[model samples]
Target: MIASVGLVRYAKCVLFGASTPRPEPDSGKVDFSAAAAAEVSVPADFRCPISLELMKDPVVVASGQTYDRESISHWIASGHATCPKTGQALAHQNLVPNKALKNLISLWCREENIPFDVTESEPNAVTANKAATEAARMTASFLVETLAASKETDAANRIVHELRQLATSGSDVRSFIGGAGGIPLLVPLLSSSEPNLQLNAVTALLNLSVLEANKKRIMHADGAIDGIVCVLSSGATWRARENAAAAVVSLSGVHSYRRRLGRDRRIVAELVNLVNVGPISTRKYSLDALASLAGDRENIRRLVESGVIKVALEAVEDADSADEAVAVLAALAKRGGAPELGVQEGVVRKLVRVLKNGSDSGRANAASALVYLCRKAGGGNLVAELAVVPGVEWVIWEMMASGTERGRRKAAALGRICRRWAVAAEADRLAARYSDVSLTVASSTRMAVAQ
Candidate 1:
């Protein structure tokens, strides 16, 4: 644990840049205390232009601009494509790590006794836990004071780094943070123009959102929804999109919050776009958010209007995401605006496929969706034959009507299902054939021949 702590501190410091907040030395204090000069003085060339800290892992940007590697990475990740100092278009953005500068900084810190207490380790769990709690309590207080005391982005950056570190510790740390006024402090940072702050703020919130108490508090926080929506609106950075989506997904699990989340069309649009084209993990989070929001019938209307059902059709065909896609479809399938679009996009075939070759839970969801579709078709509205799957409605209806009350379950076997073939056989417009041949469901002529 001690070794890991040192590595993290080293990594955090390596993000040094000149653009960061630097505390100006007080000339009055310098004159009064001669030792202050010795404490503050460092070789000028050793500092990063962006952070003004002695560089740990220095690197050169494409514009011949030298900066710490982590700092430059944060800059580029915030959607900067050009040099921060020169404003010149970079032919490419790359950081070539400077090993010589790193070694020099290590040697310098060693000589200055800077590594004297990088981490406090007592090797006793109880003692370590107390120390960590005290540190977290103090750090949380510092953040509250900093935000209230000054309007400095750099200072905020440093505070957010600690918030992120604490967040990564575990849910217990996150609970500690929520009690320390971390959620409210973290909410405003999501609107920050600083990419690094926005990244960590959202990450910290996400880590805490696993607690239902934090989720409710965060949802009601001022500027929270708008801040998250703004991040989703930014198509530029993966950090913003990924973490913001994750935060939304976490907060969205609370049943009461679904209506408010679904009411935001921009968020809904962004989620839809993400599903159709975002990174794989982003797609999963986005889909989960949409599915939860689909709890509201009006939100389901919006999702259908966004043509998500078609995207869902495509998503269902993929093995990795099939269950998640099915979950979303099931959520939306029972609503008015969703059914026609789903059927138009060949959802019947997809649902049947899910029913045939899905896990018990997946199959139940698919079967429920199929039943909902059946009810929609049979519900006083005349749906065109081509607009619906030919015999799936008949199949689902039969299973429900004749499914026995035996042992609290029925239709667990195809034999029970075959007995209900008589229902399909008796209908004049339908042609149902059953044999002892195979146990597959043939909802249409094509399916039967394929079987």
Candidate 2:
């Protein structure tokens, strides 16, 4: 054990080009100070060549290359006979535990204040379901600690990337990350100038928010929503912005969270911007978040006020976003924003076009929005205008014929409004024409009588 500690100090000296006096074996503890541990980088040999992460359990295969036990086991299980690093064919598929290296890594982790349980790292330990869960929990705790202590941008980026991966693994692991206090640490990195760090941090939050408990934890964390909004508005990469929007969608799943997000005009504006200008996937995510926000009545007003109607109108023309855009419009209309939505230039026309030629969902939502507009006070004029659109009547007929039950109901209602408004408009036109003929005849009779 003294020799192993000596080896660790020598390896650190070689890697970091600094030296410290060897610890006395009688002390039974490594003499490295916390300051020294903070400065000591992980030795190259201590990291698994495959994962490039500190090895929890080091193992050697036939080619004499050391890798993390879990990593090498996965490699062999994938039917690869050759060593990953050397590409040399394995004479046998056996992995020998490098107990000395494992001990060195353990001592190094202890000195660095990183949690690494040797028992958890054993291959047989992971075979049991409970052991695997515990191992994930410990791993999450270690990652959270590393992320919190890391000052180097590159190191922080790598740790966050790993946290993102772990958060995505399963709901249990996501719960573990939240329990490990990873949410607060990740919230600050959402605004990181390092592009990868910001991207990974926001994405990890998105993954963590999949669990209901983590969603509350994330929202309650200070500056969490602000950090996410900053990323959504001006992130370093489009993917970062996209993931930030996705995080909003995840958080907006809760009613209270949705209302809180909806209160932020910046959040609504950014979502509208993304719906207007982002790529297909980004637009989809932004629209999804907007849809959730629109569930609140006040949010619907904010969305409409943020020029979302124009964005949705433009998006309705896109086959990729037609359904989502129309869904948002439907939500807005259903939530008392019908007057605002109905007044937008070309909105009715665009919705009619969607009803005629868009996807099933788009058509249904368009139908719903139109029905809402026609039900508002003084909506007969709007209905009259809709009835004149060339294909709207046929579209309504088709919806009633082949649409879902809800679609059929909306279509039937719209059809009745159109027919009623059309009849009323004709009656008004006839009344004006009749009055005109009477005036003309009266003028003729007066002129004849005066002559």
Question: What is the per-residue lDDT of model 2 for residues 144-253, given as tens digits with 9 covering 90 to 100?
Answer: 88778888877777677667766644566778889999999999998888776777788778768766789899989999989988998998777778777777766775
Pairs of residues at least 3 apart in sequence or in different chains that clash in candidate 2: none
Error of 2 at 122 (Å): 28
Per-residue alpha-carbon lDDT of candidate 1 for residues 112-175, written as tens digits (9 for 90 to 100): 6554222321232312466555554554555555555546777777676556654544344556
Residue 388 CA displacement from its true place in model 2, Å = 1.6
Candidate 2 least-lDDT 10 residues: 24-33
For the record, the alpha-carbon RMSD of candidate 2 to the native fold, in angstroms, is 18.4
Question: Which stretches in model 1 have alpha-carbon errors above 4 Å?
Answer: 1-135, 147-150, 335-338, 356-361, 379-422, 427-451
Task: Name the top TM-score candidate.
Answer: 2
